[model samples]
Target: MIKKVLSFAVIGVSTVTLAIGLSPNTASAALGDQPEVFHSSYNPGKSTVTISTSNTEKKPVKASGYLSKYFKGYAHKAKNGKWQFHLDGYGDAEGLYNNVRNDQTVRVYLSEGKEQGAFDVKVKTIVKKNKVKKKKAIKISKAINGKNVKIKNNKRKSDVITIKKVSKNDKITIYNAKGKRLVQKTAKGNTIKIYVRQLGKKAGAVNVSTQKKGYKESGKIKVKYGRE
Candidate 1:
Protein backbone atom coordinates (compact mmCIF):
# COMPACT_ATOMS: atom_id res chain seq x y z
CA MET A 1 0.00 0.00 0.00
CA ILE A 2 3.03 2.30 -0.30
CA LYS A 3 2.76 3.16 3.34
CA LYS A 4 -0.83 4.09 2.82
CA VAL A 5 0.11 6.44 0.04
CA LEU A 6 2.79 8.18 2.02
CA SER A 7 0.47 8.62 4.93
CA PHE A 8 -2.15 10.31 2.79
CA ALA A 9 0.38 12.73 1.35
CA VAL A 10 1.62 13.85 4.70
CA ILE A 11 -1.84 14.51 5.99
CA GLY A 12 -2.67 16.58 2.96
CA VAL A 13 0.29 18.85 3.48
CA SER A 14 -0.37 19.34 7.13
CA THR A 15 -3.97 20.28 6.51
CA VAL A 16 -2.98 23.03 4.12
CA THR A 17 -0.47 24.42 6.56
CA LEU A 18 -2.99 24.48 9.29
CA ALA A 19 -5.46 26.27 7.06
CA ILE A 20 -2.94 28.98 6.21
CA GLY A 21 -1.88 29.46 9.76
CA LEU A 22 -5.40 29.93 11.09
CA SER A 23 -6.32 32.38 8.36
CA PRO A 24 -8.16 35.68 9.01
CA ASN A 25 -6.13 36.90 6.04
CA THR A 26 -2.92 35.69 7.71
CA ALA A 27 -3.69 37.83 10.79
CA SER A 28 -1.10 40.27 12.19
CA ALA A 29 -2.21 43.87 11.79
CA ALA A 30 -4.49 45.31 14.46
CA LEU A 31 -4.99 48.77 15.98
CA GLY A 32 -6.72 50.43 13.07
CA ASP A 33 -5.37 48.99 9.86
CA GLN A 34 -6.40 51.06 6.82
CA PRO A 35 -5.04 50.69 3.33
CA GLU A 36 -6.17 49.60 -0.10
CA VAL A 37 -4.47 52.25 -2.22
CA PHE A 38 -3.63 55.91 -1.50
CA HIS A 39 -1.60 58.50 -3.33
CA SER A 40 -1.29 62.33 -3.45
CA SER A 41 0.21 65.51 -4.93
CA TYR A 42 -0.59 69.17 -4.26
CA ASN A 43 0.86 72.55 -5.17
CA PRO A 44 -2.15 74.75 -5.31
CA GLY A 45 -0.55 76.56 -2.45
CA LYS A 46 2.34 73.47 -0.95
CA SER A 47 1.87 70.54 1.40
CA THR A 48 -0.47 67.79 2.55
CA VAL A 49 -0.40 64.04 1.82
CA THR A 50 -1.92 61.08 3.62
CA ILE A 51 -2.63 57.31 3.79
CA SER A 52 -3.46 55.17 6.85
CA THR A 53 -3.13 51.61 8.14
CA SER A 54 -3.20 49.67 11.44
CA ASN A 55 -4.88 46.49 10.15
CA THR A 56 -7.95 46.01 12.31
CA GLU A 57 -10.17 44.96 9.36
CA LYS A 58 -11.96 47.44 7.12
CA LYS A 59 -10.46 48.31 3.78
CA PRO A 60 -11.31 50.54 0.83
CA VAL A 61 -8.61 52.64 -0.73
CA LYS A 62 -8.53 53.15 -4.46
CA ALA A 63 -7.29 56.45 -5.82
CA SER A 64 -4.05 55.78 -7.58
CA GLY A 65 -4.94 55.83 -11.24
CA TYR A 66 -2.60 58.82 -11.44
CA LEU A 67 -4.21 60.88 -8.71
CA SER A 68 -5.40 64.07 -10.37
CA LYS A 69 -8.49 65.68 -8.98
CA TYR A 70 -7.23 68.74 -10.80
CA PHE A 71 -4.16 70.89 -10.22
CA LYS A 72 -2.23 69.80 -13.23
CA GLY A 73 -4.03 72.42 -15.23
CA TYR A 74 -2.44 74.99 -12.94
CA ALA A 75 -3.42 78.54 -11.88
CA HIS A 76 -3.09 79.24 -8.19
CA LYS A 77 -2.97 82.47 -6.22
CA ALA A 78 -5.92 82.94 -3.93
CA LYS A 79 -6.51 84.14 -0.39
CA ASN A 80 -8.73 87.14 -0.84
CA GLY A 81 -6.54 89.85 -2.33
CA LYS A 82 -7.71 89.75 -5.92
CA TRP A 83 -8.63 86.22 -7.07
CA GLN A 84 -7.38 83.34 -9.33
CA PHE A 85 -8.13 79.64 -9.23
CA HIS A 86 -7.92 76.91 -11.85
CA LEU A 87 -7.36 73.23 -11.25
CA ASP A 88 -8.97 72.45 -14.62
CA GLY A 89 -9.41 68.65 -14.40
CA TYR A 90 -9.12 65.40 -12.54
CA GLY A 91 -11.47 63.55 -10.14
CA ASP A 92 -12.23 61.20 -7.24
CA ALA A 93 -10.78 61.99 -3.80
CA GLU A 94 -13.09 63.07 -0.98
CA GLY A 95 -13.70 60.94 2.13
CA LEU A 96 -15.29 57.77 3.50
CA TYR A 97 -13.61 55.20 5.68
CA ASN A 98 -14.87 52.37 7.86
CA ASN A 99 -14.05 50.63 11.19
CA VAL A 100 -11.90 53.46 12.51
CA ARG A 101 -8.78 53.05 10.43
CA ASN A 102 -5.27 53.90 11.64
CA ASP A 103 -3.36 56.17 9.28
CA GLN A 104 -5.33 57.85 6.54
CA THR A 105 -4.52 61.49 5.92
CA VAL A 106 -4.90 63.29 2.59
CA ARG A 107 -7.05 66.37 2.68
CA VAL A 108 -6.70 69.55 0.66
CA TYR A 109 -9.53 72.02 0.19
CA LEU A 110 -8.94 75.63 -0.80
CA SER A 111 -10.66 77.55 -3.54
CA GLU A 112 -13.71 79.55 -2.64
CA GLY A 113 -12.15 82.22 -0.53
CA LYS A 114 -8.98 80.21 -0.07
CA GLU A 115 -7.62 79.09 3.33
CA GLN A 116 -5.88 75.86 4.31
CA GLY A 117 -2.21 76.44 4.57
CA ALA A 118 0.74 74.07 4.84
CA PHE A 119 1.32 74.51 1.12
CA ASP A 120 -0.24 73.24 -2.10
CA VAL A 121 -0.15 76.25 -4.38
CA LYS A 122 -0.16 80.03 -3.90
CA VAL A 123 1.80 82.47 -6.01
CA LYS A 124 0.81 86.12 -5.91
CA THR A 125 2.09 89.45 -7.17
CA ILE A 126 0.54 91.98 -9.52
CA VAL A 127 -0.20 95.61 -8.74
CA LYS A 128 1.55 97.82 -11.28
CA LYS A 129 0.23 101.24 -10.18
CA ASN A 130 -2.04 102.61 -7.43
CA LYS A 131 -0.81 105.54 -5.37
CA VAL A 132 -4.00 106.80 -3.63
CA LYS A 133 -4.22 110.28 -2.09
CA LYS A 134 -7.33 112.45 -1.99
CA LYS A 135 -9.03 113.83 1.14
CA LYS A 136 -8.48 117.56 1.74
CA ALA A 137 -11.46 119.65 2.80
CA ILE A 138 -11.61 120.60 6.47
CA LYS A 139 -13.06 123.89 7.70
CA ILE A 140 -14.55 124.29 11.19
CA SER A 141 -16.16 127.40 12.69
CA LYS A 142 -17.67 128.50 16.05
CA ALA A 143 -18.95 132.05 16.68
CA ILE A 144 -22.08 132.05 18.83
CA ASN A 145 -20.42 134.86 20.84
CA GLY A 146 -16.86 134.74 19.43
CA LYS A 147 -13.47 133.78 21.02
CA ASN A 148 -11.44 133.10 17.87
CA VAL A 149 -12.18 129.49 16.78
CA LYS A 150 -12.53 129.16 12.98
CA ILE A 151 -10.25 126.46 11.64
CA LYS A 152 -10.38 126.57 7.82
CA ASN A 153 -9.34 124.34 4.92
CA ASN A 154 -12.11 124.73 2.32
CA LYS A 155 -10.67 121.60 0.72
CA ARG A 156 -11.93 119.59 3.72
CA LYS A 157 -15.19 121.48 3.71
CA SER A 158 -18.54 120.31 5.07
CA ASP A 159 -19.81 122.19 8.12
CA VAL A 160 -23.10 122.99 9.83
CA ILE A 161 -24.06 123.07 13.54
CA THR A 162 -26.49 125.86 14.26
CA ILE A 163 -28.77 125.72 17.31
CA LYS A 164 -30.98 128.77 17.89
CA LYS A 165 -33.68 127.91 20.40
CA VAL A 166 -35.87 130.59 21.93
CA SER A 167 -39.23 128.83 22.28
CA LYS A 168 -38.93 125.08 21.61
CA ASN A 169 -37.08 122.52 19.40
CA ASP A 170 -33.44 123.02 20.32
CA LYS A 171 -32.90 119.29 20.94
CA ILE A 172 -29.51 118.63 19.32
CA THR A 173 -26.93 115.84 19.87
CA ILE A 174 -23.37 114.80 19.15
CA TYR A 175 -22.52 113.39 22.59
CA ASN A 176 -19.53 111.45 23.88
CA ALA A 177 -20.38 111.41 27.64
CA LYS A 178 -20.00 107.70 27.03
CA GLY A 179 -23.06 108.23 24.79
CA LYS A 180 -20.62 107.68 21.96
CA ARG A 181 -21.69 108.77 18.44
CA LEU A 182 -18.90 110.53 16.57
CA VAL A 183 -21.38 112.20 14.24
CA GLN A 184 -25.19 112.43 13.91
CA LYS A 185 -27.16 115.47 12.67
CA THR A 186 -30.91 116.08 12.83
CA ALA A 187 -32.15 119.61 13.33
CA LYS A 188 -33.54 119.84 9.85
CA GLY A 189 -35.42 123.20 9.95
CA ASN A 190 -35.60 125.07 13.29
CA THR A 191 -32.03 126.25 12.82
CA ILE A 192 -30.30 123.01 13.80
CA LYS A 193 -27.46 123.41 11.24
CA ILE A 194 -25.78 120.12 12.21
CA TYR A 195 -23.38 118.83 9.51
CA VAL A 196 -20.38 119.40 11.70
CA ARG A 197 -17.53 117.55 9.94
CA GLN A 198 -20.18 115.31 8.38
CA LEU A 199 -23.20 115.03 10.65
CA GLY A 200 -22.56 116.46 14.15
CA LYS A 201 -19.85 117.16 16.70
CA LYS A 202 -18.80 120.75 17.15
CA ALA A 203 -18.24 120.21 20.83
CA GLY A 204 -17.79 117.29 23.21
CA ALA A 205 -20.81 116.83 25.52
CA VAL A 206 -23.47 117.78 22.98
CA ASN A 207 -27.13 117.33 24.03
CA VAL A 208 -30.38 116.01 22.57
CA SER A 209 -29.19 113.45 19.96
CA THR A 210 -32.75 112.03 20.27
CA GLN A 211 -33.95 113.01 16.81
CA LYS A 212 -33.01 109.35 16.68
CA LYS A 213 -29.38 109.08 15.56
CA GLY A 214 -27.86 107.98 18.88
CA TYR A 215 -30.17 109.23 21.67
CA LYS A 216 -28.35 111.68 23.94
CA GLU A 217 -31.01 114.22 24.88
CA SER A 218 -29.90 114.64 28.53
CA GLY A 219 -29.35 118.45 28.54
CA LYS A 220 -26.07 120.27 27.87
CA ILE A 221 -25.25 123.78 26.65
CA LYS A 222 -22.30 126.17 26.36
CA VAL A 223 -22.08 125.39 22.66
CA LYS A 224 -18.76 127.14 23.24
CA TYR A 225 -18.79 130.91 23.51
CA GLY A 226 -15.98 133.39 22.64
CA ARG A 227 -14.71 132.54 19.15
CA GLU A 228 -14.90 134.18 15.73
Candidate 2:
Protein backbone atom coordinates (compact mmCIF):
# COMPACT_ATOMS: atom_id res chain seq x y z
CA MET A 1 0.00 0.00 0.00
CA ILE A 2 2.89 2.51 0.74
CA LYS A 3 4.43 1.81 -2.67
CA LYS A 4 1.10 2.59 -4.37
CA VAL A 5 0.86 6.02 -2.57
CA LEU A 6 4.43 6.92 -3.60
CA SER A 7 3.64 6.18 -7.27
CA PHE A 8 0.57 8.49 -7.23
CA ALA A 9 2.58 11.39 -5.68
CA VAL A 10 5.27 11.04 -8.41
CA ILE A 11 2.64 11.24 -11.15
CA GLY A 12 1.11 14.40 -9.66
CA VAL A 13 4.53 16.14 -9.57
CA SER A 14 5.15 15.31 -13.20
CA THR A 15 1.74 16.66 -14.25
CA VAL A 16 2.35 19.99 -12.49
CA THR A 17 5.76 20.37 -14.20
CA LEU A 18 4.20 19.78 -17.61
CA ALA A 19 1.51 22.40 -17.00
CA ILE A 20 4.13 25.00 -15.99
CA GLY A 21 6.09 24.32 -19.17
CA LEU A 22 3.01 25.10 -21.30
CA SER A 23 2.10 28.34 -19.50
CA PRO A 24 1.74 31.65 -21.40
CA ASN A 25 4.83 33.04 -19.68
CA THR A 26 6.93 30.29 -21.18
CA ALA A 27 5.43 30.89 -24.60
CA SER A 28 6.02 34.63 -24.43
CA ALA A 29 9.69 34.14 -23.68
CA ALA A 30 9.99 32.63 -27.13
CA LEU A 31 8.42 35.75 -28.70
CA GLY A 32 11.86 37.15 -29.36
CA ASP A 33 11.95 34.82 -32.37
CA GLN A 34 8.43 35.80 -33.46
CA PRO A 35 7.26 38.88 -35.35
CA GLU A 36 6.66 42.15 -33.54
CA VAL A 37 3.04 43.07 -32.86
CA PHE A 38 1.52 46.54 -32.37
CA HIS A 39 -1.83 48.30 -32.18
CA SER A 40 -2.45 51.87 -33.30
CA SER A 41 -5.17 54.46 -32.63
CA TYR A 42 -5.67 58.11 -33.53
CA ASN A 43 -7.75 60.99 -32.22
CA PRO A 44 -10.14 62.74 -34.58
CA GLY A 45 -9.45 66.45 -35.27
CA LYS A 46 -6.26 66.23 -33.29
CA SER A 47 -2.67 65.53 -34.27
CA THR A 48 -2.11 62.73 -31.77
CA VAL A 49 -1.37 59.06 -32.51
CA THR A 50 -1.16 56.32 -29.91
CA ILE A 51 0.63 53.03 -30.40
CA SER A 52 0.59 50.15 -27.95
CA THR A 53 2.83 47.11 -27.80
CA SER A 54 1.31 43.67 -27.32
CA ASN A 55 4.27 42.85 -25.17
CA THR A 56 4.24 44.98 -22.02
CA GLU A 57 7.90 45.96 -22.27
CA LYS A 58 8.74 49.61 -22.75
CA LYS A 59 10.51 49.25 -26.06
CA PRO A 60 11.28 52.34 -28.15
CA VAL A 61 9.69 52.70 -31.56
CA LYS A 62 10.17 54.84 -34.65
CA ALA A 63 7.25 55.94 -36.80
CA SER A 64 7.57 56.79 -40.49
CA GLY A 65 5.53 57.27 -43.67
CA TYR A 66 2.30 59.21 -44.18
CA LEU A 67 1.64 61.99 -41.63
CA SER A 68 4.34 60.65 -39.40
CA LYS A 69 6.87 62.13 -41.79
CA TYR A 70 6.02 65.62 -40.50
CA PHE A 71 6.34 64.80 -36.81
CA LYS A 72 8.43 67.42 -35.06
CA GLY A 73 9.88 65.27 -32.30
CA TYR A 74 10.77 61.66 -31.54
CA ALA A 75 8.13 59.22 -30.32
CA HIS A 76 8.11 58.40 -26.63
CA LYS A 77 6.11 56.25 -24.25
CA ALA A 78 3.72 58.08 -21.97
CA LYS A 79 2.84 57.33 -18.36
CA ASN A 80 -0.22 55.42 -19.56
CA GLY A 81 2.04 52.69 -21.07
CA LYS A 82 1.35 53.70 -24.67
CA TRP A 83 3.72 55.30 -27.17
CA GLN A 84 2.62 58.70 -28.37
CA PHE A 85 3.62 60.67 -31.48
CA HIS A 86 2.49 64.11 -32.52
CA LEU A 87 2.07 65.77 -35.91
CA ASP A 88 2.89 69.40 -35.15
CA GLY A 89 1.83 72.45 -37.12
CA TYR A 90 -0.68 75.31 -37.05
CA GLY A 91 -2.77 73.81 -39.84
CA ASP A 92 -2.74 70.23 -38.61
CA ALA A 93 -6.10 69.19 -40.00
CA GLU A 94 -5.46 70.43 -43.52
CA GLY A 95 -1.94 69.10 -43.58
CA LEU A 96 -2.98 65.69 -42.30
CA TYR A 97 -5.71 65.37 -44.89
CA ASN A 98 -3.36 66.27 -47.74
CA ASN A 99 -0.56 63.96 -46.61
CA VAL A 100 -2.54 60.82 -45.74
CA ARG A 101 -5.58 59.37 -47.44
CA ASN A 102 -8.08 56.81 -46.24
CA ASP A 103 -6.69 53.47 -45.10
CA GLN A 104 -3.04 54.53 -45.23
CA THR A 105 -0.24 52.70 -43.49
CA VAL A 106 2.37 53.93 -41.04
CA ARG A 107 5.59 52.02 -40.61
CA VAL A 108 6.70 51.26 -37.07
CA TYR A 109 10.21 50.04 -36.34
CA LEU A 110 11.27 48.23 -33.18
CA SER A 111 14.40 46.60 -31.89
CA GLU A 112 14.27 43.18 -30.21
CA GLY A 113 17.59 42.30 -28.64
CA LYS A 114 20.23 42.74 -31.36
CA GLU A 115 17.69 42.17 -34.17
CA GLN A 116 15.33 44.75 -35.63
CA GLY A 117 11.68 44.25 -36.54
CA ALA A 118 9.12 46.34 -38.43
CA PHE A 119 5.38 46.37 -38.91
CA ASP A 120 2.73 48.46 -40.63
CA VAL A 121 -0.26 49.99 -38.83
CA LYS A 122 -3.37 50.99 -40.66
CA VAL A 123 -4.44 54.57 -40.10
CA LYS A 124 -7.77 55.18 -38.36
CA THR A 125 -10.44 57.51 -39.63
CA ILE A 126 -9.91 61.10 -38.47
CA VAL A 127 -12.07 64.15 -38.84
CA LYS A 128 -10.64 66.13 -41.72
CA LYS A 129 -12.24 69.42 -40.72
CA ASN A 130 -11.22 71.42 -37.69
CA LYS A 131 -13.21 74.27 -36.29
CA VAL A 132 -11.49 77.64 -36.62
CA LYS A 133 -12.37 80.76 -34.68
CA LYS A 134 -13.21 83.75 -36.80
CA LYS A 135 -11.17 86.82 -36.10
CA LYS A 136 -12.77 90.13 -35.13
CA ALA A 137 -12.11 93.30 -37.10
CA ILE A 138 -10.06 95.96 -35.35
CA LYS A 139 -11.62 99.37 -35.02
CA ILE A 140 -9.87 102.59 -34.04
CA SER A 141 -11.39 105.11 -31.64
CA LYS A 142 -12.55 108.35 -33.18
CA ALA A 143 -11.00 110.17 -30.21
CA ILE A 144 -7.55 109.69 -31.72
CA ASN A 145 -7.63 110.35 -35.44
CA GLY A 146 -4.41 109.71 -37.37
CA LYS A 147 -3.93 113.46 -37.88
CA ASN A 148 -2.23 116.39 -36.15
CA VAL A 149 -0.96 114.51 -33.11
CA LYS A 150 1.52 116.06 -30.70
CA ILE A 151 4.88 114.36 -30.19
CA LYS A 152 7.89 115.15 -27.99
CA ASN A 153 11.49 114.85 -29.13
CA ASN A 154 12.31 113.29 -25.76
CA LYS A 155 12.93 109.57 -26.36
CA ARG A 156 11.84 108.92 -22.77
CA LYS A 157 8.30 110.10 -23.52
CA SER A 158 5.68 108.65 -25.86
CA ASP A 159 2.21 109.62 -27.16
CA VAL A 160 -0.49 107.15 -26.22
CA ILE A 161 -3.24 106.37 -28.77
CA THR A 162 -6.48 104.78 -27.54
CA ILE A 163 -8.00 102.07 -29.68
CA LYS A 164 -11.63 100.87 -29.76
CA LYS A 165 -13.49 97.72 -30.73
CA VAL A 166 -10.43 95.60 -30.01
CA SER A 167 -10.32 91.82 -29.63
CA LYS A 168 -8.09 89.90 -27.32
CA ASN A 169 -6.33 88.33 -30.28
CA ASP A 170 -5.74 91.63 -32.07
CA LYS A 171 -2.20 92.93 -32.42
CA ILE A 172 -1.50 96.63 -32.57
CA THR A 173 1.48 97.78 -34.60
CA ILE A 174 3.00 101.23 -34.84
CA TYR A 175 5.07 102.11 -37.88
CA ASN A 176 7.14 105.17 -38.68
CA ALA A 177 6.98 107.10 -41.93
CA LYS A 178 9.72 104.84 -43.29
CA GLY A 179 7.45 101.79 -42.70
CA LYS A 180 9.58 100.57 -39.81
CA ARG A 181 7.78 98.86 -36.97
CA LEU A 182 8.19 100.77 -33.76
CA VAL A 183 5.92 98.93 -31.32
CA GLN A 184 3.75 95.79 -31.42
CA LYS A 185 1.40 94.68 -28.66
CA THR A 186 -1.55 92.33 -28.18
CA ALA A 187 -4.87 93.77 -27.07
CA LYS A 188 -6.08 92.59 -23.68
CA GLY A 189 -9.39 94.49 -23.49
CA ASN A 190 -11.82 96.48 -25.60
CA THR A 191 -9.30 99.38 -25.46
CA ILE A 192 -5.57 99.41 -25.97
CA LYS A 193 -2.92 102.10 -25.86
CA ILE A 194 -0.23 102.53 -28.55
CA TYR A 195 2.83 104.54 -27.57
CA VAL A 196 4.68 106.52 -30.24
CA ARG A 197 8.01 108.27 -29.81
CA GLN A 198 10.35 110.32 -31.96
CA LEU A 199 13.61 108.44 -32.45
CA GLY A 200 15.12 111.47 -34.17
CA LYS A 201 15.02 115.25 -33.52
CA LYS A 202 12.86 115.85 -36.59
CA ALA A 203 9.11 115.33 -36.41
CA GLY A 204 7.44 112.86 -38.81
CA ALA A 205 4.30 110.84 -39.52
CA VAL A 206 3.61 107.50 -37.83
CA ASN A 207 1.26 104.81 -39.17
CA VAL A 208 -0.80 102.57 -36.92
CA SER A 209 -2.40 99.26 -37.91
CA THR A 210 -4.21 96.36 -36.26
CA GLN A 211 -3.76 92.72 -37.23
CA LYS A 212 -5.66 89.54 -36.35
CA LYS A 213 -6.49 86.22 -37.97
CA GLY A 214 -9.51 85.92 -40.34
CA TYR A 215 -10.10 89.65 -40.22
CA LYS A 216 -9.16 92.31 -42.79
CA GLU A 217 -6.09 94.22 -41.73
CA SER A 218 -6.82 97.68 -40.41
CA GLY A 219 -5.27 99.95 -42.99
CA LYS A 220 -2.41 102.13 -41.90
CA ILE A 221 -3.43 105.34 -40.17
CA LYS A 222 -1.16 108.37 -40.52
CA VAL A 223 -0.60 110.49 -37.45
CA LYS A 224 1.46 113.74 -37.61
CA TYR A 225 4.00 114.22 -34.89
CA GLY A 226 5.70 117.50 -33.85
CA ARG A 227 8.13 118.54 -31.14
CA GLU A 228 6.32 119.23 -27.87
Best by TM-score: 2
Candidate 2 lDDT tens digits, 22-136: 4565566655545333323332112334333321223422233332433322233479964544322222222331123335555443333232344344543333243698987
Q: How well is each residue in 1-228 modelled by candidate 1, as lDDT tens digits?
A: 111111223644552222223334334232123424322333333432222221111321222323333322222224766423222223432242221112323344422122322223222222234558878654322223212122221225555455553113333455444555646544455344555453223333333333323332443333332222
Best by lDDT: 2
TM-score of each model, paired residue for residue: 0.17, 0.31
lDDT for model 1 comes to 0.33
The weakest ten consecutive residues by lDDT in model 2 span 89-98
Off by over 4 Å in 2: 1-155
Q: After superposing candidate 1 on the true structure, give the runs of residues whose Cα lies further than 4 Å from its correct spot.
A: 1-20, 25-34, 40-168, 171-228
